[model samples]
Target: MRPSTQIKPISLLKTQTAQVIRRVCEDREPLIITQNGEAKAVILDIQSYEDQQDTVALLKILALGSRQIAAGEVKPAGEVFERLRKLER
Candidate 1:
């Protein structure tokens, strides 16, 4: 499910720049800026942006893992566990 997006016209940003930014920071939701009735830019809070970046990085890692498995490059789980168990001895 997608988060609810707030849309505001470019004129609003031009007129109420600080208010818009304050609201975005407080809400932690993306604000879509539209130009001539078309979407153009998005305003996001710093924390949300960082979280999104982290999620994207994790997704990339998962995708790489999937590709490795598909290419028959995965180690056997039993063998890997046996090695770890030996290390614990």
Candidate 2:
């Protein structure tokens, strides 16, 4: 995040929505939309938004796997591979 990046007021969004969209897409950076000097929302390019969603989904899956492991709800590696091989058939 660059300190020099200007934060736009929410009111400007009503009139400069297209400009904001173009800038964010071209720079691949989020625009902070502010209201009354406080951060209110962010505008992200479609690719960045989807990438963020994917990252969050992956993190959730990893968290679930960690919890399962902690609960001893995991099979041995060889056993898991054997089951996968059977499924392949």
* Model 1 ranges off by over 4 Å: 1-5, 77-89
Q: Model 2, residue 3: displacement in angstroms?
A: 4.2
Top TM-score prediction, candidate number:
2
Report lDDT per candidate.
0.92, 0.91
**For candidate 1, which ten residues in a row score worst on lDDT?**
1-10
Q: Write the per-residue lDDT of candidate 1 for residues 1-89, one digit (tens) a residue.
A: 14344988999999999999999999898999999999999999999999999999999999999999999999999999999999999
Q: Relative to the unseen true structure, what is the C-alpha lDDT of residue 12 in candidate 2, on a scale of 0 to 100?
A: 86
Instruction: Tell me the tens digit of each residue's lDDT in model 2 across 1-89.
Output: 68458578999898988888998999998888899999999899999999999999999999999999999999999999999999999
Best by lDDT: 1
Q: What is the lDDT of candidate 1?
A: 0.92
Each candidate's TM vs. the true structure?
0.80, 0.86
